[model samples]
Target chain A: MSIQIWTFILVGITFAIYLSIAWMSRVRDTRGFYVAGGGVPALANGMATAADWMSAASFISMAGLISFMGYTGCVYLMGWTGGYVLLALLLAPYLRKFGKFTVPDFVGDRYYSDGARVVALVCAIFASLTYVAGQMRGVGIVFSRFLEVDVNTGVIIGMIIVFIYAGLGGMKGITWTQVAQYCVLILAFLIPAVAISIKITGHFIPQIGFGGVISEGANAGRYLLDTLNAISADLGFDQYTQAFGPNSKSMLDVAAITLALMVGTAGLPHVIIRFYTVPSVKAARLSAGYALLFIAILYTTAPSVAVFARYNMIDTLNNVAYEQAPSWFKNWEKTGLIAWVDKNGDGKMEYRAGKAIEGKPKLTGQTGIYGQALVSNKVVDSNANELYVDRDIMVLANPEIADLPAWVIALVAAGGLAAALSTASGLLLVIASSISHDLYYRIINRSASEKQRLLLGRIMIGVAVCAAGYFGINPPGFVAQVVAFAFGLAASSFFPILVLGIFWKRASKEGAITGMVLGIGFTMLYIIQTKFLGVGNWFFGISPEGIGTVGMILNFAATVLVSLVTKAPPQDIQDMVESIRTPRGAGLATDH
Target chain B: MENQDRLKEYWRRNLRLMLVLLAIWAVVSYGFSIVFVQALNKIHLGGFPLGFWFAQQGSIYTFVGLIFVYVWRMRRLDREYDVHE
Candidate 1:
């Protein structure tokens, strides 16, 4: 069967499963909509949290980035997983004990100020919107490539699917669907990775295979990392096994990026809200452990998959004849993701080091079946490399690259859609609830009925989904880049406030409000100045990816300084803080 | 007075345990993986440089271990404090 037909069948089946789960778990009230009625089992919530946390970036783009960036990419692996440690220890149980439905709810009540709640609401909306945009774009890419639809149409289709589940079941619907998604995505991720590992190292476990000796290649007896490093060095890239330091990324740069990612992961409202669904503080803690364990299955495998994919691409494409290239190469070429120009008219492709060549190559009179130019303008310069490959293509094309069966490739398409859809729905829920519950019900109309709140939540979901779809159709940047910005913003705005609110009894509402504004403001200024205006060098050599660390520090300082000068929170609020610290009587989530 | 002392002691014990676990977390990720990476990479662990392994795989395993340890110890702590729910 054709790949498209297989993709359609697989994708269709998965969507049907998600829709059915949504229907069965349809929510009845605001609690069901917000925190899944606080009855979710720890293990199930763990799976759902894993799905919610691992977005399109982790599923589709992380390995690709790791493949290209080498050891510098360890920042992502360590940073993302390590944050769960902070979450489990410092935050999750207490937050659960506090029994709040939303992150902003905790912030608002703990700070005892409407202004603080409003600030948190804006932060949640900003972070969630930025995040959902990336998921929407991820959905668009999967549909456009696999389902053979236009990007915008694919986004609309994805929005409709998300709307069906998220609007109907809210958190309850999204949670169950996410459990199914976790299964699909993990299987999709693992099959190709294990298959590639077995093919390369005679080991089925990717983690061990990463260090195993190559079994059958000419490099037999060479360790996988050694072989990869040797090949990458031979091709003028840095050694794959080396850490990023003065030669490439500075140590401080690595540290800063890692710290920002860790803190950002903890601060994300969507993931934090997952803790509220579990029934008890113990369950909340256990769920975080399970979440990390599930996430680690993929996180540990990603580096191995990255090494194998990079080795495969470089080995197959380096100095290969363009005319004799594999069918998969030609297929990807038609999508304009991989391009080559016979610069020397040697009719052979050279995949080597150096920047992409300047100027466009003359196109041959070749047209695809869709009546589009088969090979759009090839970018060629006087460099040795004649091919320009998009980083996003690494995971999607891995199975095809290795000549895995069509069904496996089809499963990948389904998996990608599942990953993007699950995260998009989670983020959309965060946005919807913040608007409906925080802005509409809490602030605007304290007397709004449950029915009215539910209605507003559904309507807000519709609006948020459409807005996310718009961003998908017109993406401001690459998927991972946009996600990094979201993380940075979340770290800057939310992490410090939440932490201080929980641990520091004297943390004043005025302090939180000022800290958030200044932190977000500084981070935004830096990102805009660096990313958009291109004005000055990054401060302290921190890329915008790591600027959140600086913002977080500033937030801490501002909060501390402001709180020291301001009057302390009242006696009752201090007692409330003390009560949440102990793991006693953590029942169903309720407003204080 | 007795109840207050018990609560204070419980809080103190929890903080101490957290401090110890968090210290390990910091050492593995930031210390071994970043600050002392070059020195650690000079030592080999099978096919991987020690620092590289710590950055890519070892630190994450330790983190998972740390969390489980925390959960187990905290569970016991909750019981001791008569706060388990």
Candidate 2:
């Protein structure tokens, strides 16, 4: 069957499964709606957390990033999965013990300050919304390519589906839905890796295949890394396996970034909420262990995919004539996802980095441009600017370039959609919960009935869906770029406060408020200045890496200094901290 | 009185264990991969660079191993503390 038809069938099957799961597990009350009656199994909850954690970026962009970046791409793999260890060990169990409905609830009550809760609430919503916008865009991209629809229409459709499910079922529905999503996304990622491994190395396991030297015809035992590094250097890029940037980042910077991500991942409200679904504190802890295991499956395989794709691309096209390029090349070319132009009119695509050559125009009444129709419908200026390097193209173009069957290609399309939708649903539930449970019932209308709260939750979801759709339609910025901002904000604001509130008995309301504000505020000021004001050099030499680290350091310093300046919290708040720390109080709420 | 002694002993022991395991986790991940990668690159494992191994696989294996150990030891500690379900 054609790839399009197969994509339809696979996507159809996935949607049917989600709708069925959502239908069967409808929420009954506010408690059930918010936390699934707090009775989900630990292992199942872990799997769902994995699904929620691995968003569209993980499935679609991460491997693709590694494909071109080679060894340096290890940063994403190590940073992301390593963060989970920090989460499971340090944060999840204590938060579960806190027994709160939302992250803000923990902060507000722990500090005995509504102001602190509002700060956390602002941070959570900002992080969640930025993350959700990226997912919406991811869904739209996959749907546009596979389902043959406009990107915006696909976005609206995805938003509607999430609205119906997340609005109706809340966290209960989201957890089960995420489990299904994890299965589909993992299968989709692994199948291609396995197929390509067998094709290239005569092995099924990608990691083993990666180490096994290339066994294909005419390239037997070729070292992939050596070949890729040579190709990259040929194209005016850094050697693929070697680090190219500044040879020095302070140990402090490294520690700060790692700590920020580690704390940030654990601090993410969407991820923390998953633990609340489990039955007991022990289960909550165990669930985090399981989530890491599931995430590890993808984390380990991703580097192999990156290395293999890089080696294969260089080998397949080296010195080959342009007109005879594979169908996948032409297909991606049409989408403007990948582009190449022949210089010197040599009837061959020269994939190299060199200075521009002035030449005649290809099509013009009067022109003096380096222009020629060098290959089949491919034009080149005598002086091409540079090779196009959009990172999103890597995964979508992987299957076709590797000559995989139409079915695998279709499955990948569905997989990307699954990753996007699953995470979006999880976030939407949080957004719904924040409104229905925290804002409306707790703050705004304390006496509102459960039925009214549920209705309000659904209404809030509709509003959230519309907002997400608008961003997806006109994506404000880069997918990976926007995601980093969310992480930065979270790392700065929520992580420090949460850690202090849980671990330090003396952390007062003033300390929590000051830390969160400085963390988020400093990071925002740096980002705004760097991106808009173009005065990146002016701000403590702050680039993306430096800004997050600086923000985190400032957060720590402010919290400590402010806490020392302010009086220790009241007797009851001090007791609350002690109770949360003790294992005996596991069944009771922190305040009680 | 015996139970109280056992619980205090358990908390003291578990705290020590958690600190040790956390050290190992930090060393393998941040220490090896970020701080000491260049130094460790002089040593190789199975023809693969040691630093690359830690970045890609070794660190993850360490994390998983640490968690399982934590769970197993924590379960034992819970029994000692009379906190086991």
Candidate 3:
């Protein structure tokens, strides 16, 4: 009857489904292991791509981030979704025609250089590892809350689950599991959002309800955005719909960040790899459309959920005594992610614009006078703010804040796990494939048998999972910063080269290798300088988050310039480029 | 030689179509959503400010539409060039 029980039931059921799919789909050959025999339906591949693309960040974090950020959060919404257009138009279909097992395969063959293949795979591994670490942490957070386990134990459990499917079935297993995950995660996101929408605005459609007038609140009869704007301003925060507010990002930064993410999304190895599962060039194009449509359902609803979460947070928390606070607040507080300091000694929590405590909540593992979590953080001398809620709590605690059913809360837990686990397996598969397929077989053993390749692939997955799990528990200082730059890295590293390889016939091995090294190098150096050395915003006032666009530009320039000066590619290679331009004669994903 | 010319013409048409679509993509996302957001926010679409809606919702819808459109047009282009699989 309780939320915890419901979480166990839902998560147990979903995990059973995933493990069974993995068992049934296990493959013996390198082609089937890597590309699911290149026979997945467009509709199914679309669902898998949706699940793969929307990681822990999209499911658990984006809505909360948007809640805190207001309109400027558009950088993520547009940046992430817009990349599918580039993928559908410029990348996916042609790559499908090239018909290889990995992005590195295309790079190696097209550029006619093993060096280019190694460079691209290295970038792919680096970016994916950073992204997977974030997912493992998301899994840890969900399990820590619902299963009552420690974060490290939750990560170990997640690593084991991912290893089973990814190690055994490889891409064949991951694709099917992701399809199920897409369904579970999307439903989990929508049910709470739709219910909260109906409660507040009496509108079932969240997007339209977002504009509907509040139904039964103090701000009743006023439009939802207007009401949120009033609440935000009254709390000394910017208006809810305030575009480019003073506390928010500048216009150029928003644009640059969006461009980086869009380009980066298309370039991400895991996402592009999903196209290989499908049957044809046309399926690849159509699947991208379906992927975006499915992704849009969650993306559009996120902003609406952001509004409702902020509105409900203010309605339930501010001015309520700590003992009188909603049960969810008390429960979340035990996790130490949500804390309150009674600045005025009134025993009440006040949600305001300024910091509630210095630095972050330092839990003393003891209860305060009012039974609130006792944190050692010094109360800020500046303001009356008394709440220090982690932004992540916005989505997880939304149902509880609005008094939704326990089943929905449990569904949220399962959904978050589904999101985190699905993407982690996808990334792990890529890492394993890079080693077994690219590094070992292609580079080291051209005569390796299918059995040997499959064995190596399965073994590398276990290693990747352990490495990812360790990083999840002891996340590096750069975990959050590196994620943004991972996108920049992908943008700088892969997008330009892949596009040039397809569209430009003259692109040589020398040109691709040089562009890849310099472009990725420039982006990496900028990220390190700004993120690590604290040298902030040196290039045209763009921060590390937006520097990928500059890196991409440099890559395009370098590739084109170098290619023009160098000898043209061989005549046969030129004809190969011309041949891939047509959609006919698509091959199953395999090496020659 | 004739086949080469047809291939060139097909590639040219594809490039031309892509240019048009990408231009729309840039205009909506960069031009309206980012650069001219403030000006557009003065206009409202239902409950959402026009630019904010584009940033949050409209651009995503347009992206989905653009992809399907490309699929349909490209499929036809393939047929026209006798290149359909």
Candidate 4:
């Protein structure tokens, strides 16, 4: 069977499963919609959180990016996972004890100000919407690549599927579907990884395969990482096993990026909200641990897959004739993700160091003399590096690159859609509830009844889905530019305030407002200056990507300093913090 | 007043435990993984350099363990303070 047909069947089956789960778990009341009635089991909540946290980026792009980044990839691997430690210890339990519906709810009530809530609501919306747009774009790309549909059609299909389950079931529906998604994506990711691992190193466990010696070919008896290093060095590229390789980011910058991502993960409103669905503080704690465990299943495997995929691509494609290039090469070439410019016009493809084209390949809908796609971009004046591979293709084309079955390739398509849709729904709920629960119900219509609130929440979900889909289809160029900064903004604005609100009794609304404004404000200024305006890195050589670390530090310092000068929070609010400190008497999340 | 004293003590104990655990977390990730990585990489863990393993793989597993340990210790602390729910 063709990969396309198999994709249709697998994707069709997965869609059916998600829609059915949504139907069965359909929610009507606002509590059910917002926090799944606060009765979810810890293990299931863990699974849901994993699905919610692992977006299209995690499934489709991380390994690809890591493959090229080599040992420097630890920034993402550790940065993303370490945040759960902060979440489990410093955030989740207290937030659960406080029993709030949104991060804004906790912020507003704890700070004793509606103004603080509004600020938090805006930040939550800004960050979640930016992240959701990327997920929708990912959905569209996956559909276009696998289902053979146009990108916009694929996006519409994705939006419709999301509307069915997400609009119908809300959090209740979304949670169950995410459990199913976590299963599909993990299996899809693992099966190919395990298969390729055995083929290359005779090891079934990818973590073991990571260091396992190559079992075949001339490189047999060599460690996989060692083999990759030799090949990369031979190509005038940095060794894969070495840190701070010639092309790698500075260690200080890598540490800063990792710290930003770590705190940013903990502060994300969508991820934190998942803890509220569990029944107790204990459940919240357990669920967080389980969440990390489930996420680690994929996170640990990714580096190994990076090693195998990197080794295979270079080994097969280098010095091969263009016409006789591997089938995966030709297939991915048509998609315009991997281009061969044949700079020397020798009819041979050379995979070496340096850029082949001046910039990204622009297809003119023309074929070259060797029947390869003609790139309109100018060939760079450098070495015989004739290939340009998109980072996204590393995971997407892995099955084909390793000659896995058509079914496995189709399974990957299903898995990619599951990842994108689950994250989109989770982020949509945050945007919807931020507007409906926080803005409309709390501020605009305090006298509104349950039915009105529920209706507004559902309507807001519809609006958010459309908004996300629109941005997905016509992503403002800044959508991509601003996406990385979502974490920075979250780290700078949200993390400090939330932490201070819980741990420090004297933290005031004035202090939180000041902290958020100064922290996020400075971070944004630095990013716009360096990233957009091309200002030189003025802060100790830290790029905009790592400036969030500085922003986070400034937030903590400013919040504390402002609090010291300001009046202490009332004794009642201090007592509230004391109560949130313990695990006893936690209950269902409430708006009040 | 007596109940208040107990709550304060429980909170104090919790803070101390958290401090100890977060310290380990920082040492493994920031200490061994980043700051002292060059020194640690000289030591090998089978096929992996120790620092690289800590940075990428080991830190994640330790994070999971830390959360569970917090859960277990906090559970006992809850019982000790008669605050178990």
The residue ranges of model 4 lying beyond 4 angstroms of the native Cα positions read none
Model 4, residue A37: distance off in Å is: 0.2
C-alpha lDDT of residue A50 in model 2: 90
Off by over 4 Å in 2: A244-259, A353-389, A478-480, A537-542, A588-592, B1-14
Q: DockQ values for all predictions?
A: 0.83, 0.48, 0.82, 0.73
Ranking by DockQ: 1, 3, 4, 2
Summarize candidate 1's per-residue lDDT along A315-387 as a digit string, tens digits: 7777887666777777877676677766666767777776454443334558533232334454546567777
Q: Cα deviation in Å at residue A439, candidate 2?
A: 2.2
Clashing residue pairs, backbone N/CA/C < 3 A, model 1: A357-A381
Clashes of each: 1, 4, 0, 0
Instruction: Please tell me the interface RMSD, in Å, for model 3.
Output: 0.9
Q: What DockQ was computed for model 3?
A: 0.82
Docking model 1 quality class: high
**Tens-digit lDDT string for candidate 1 (B1-85):** 9988888789889889989999999999999988998899889887888898888899899988999999999999999899999
lDDT of 2 by residue, B2-78 (tens): 96576557656866887898899889988787677667766756435677667677888788778877777777777
TM-score of each: 0.96, 0.91, 0.98, 0.98
i-RMSD per candidate, Å: 0.9, 2.4, 0.9, 1.1
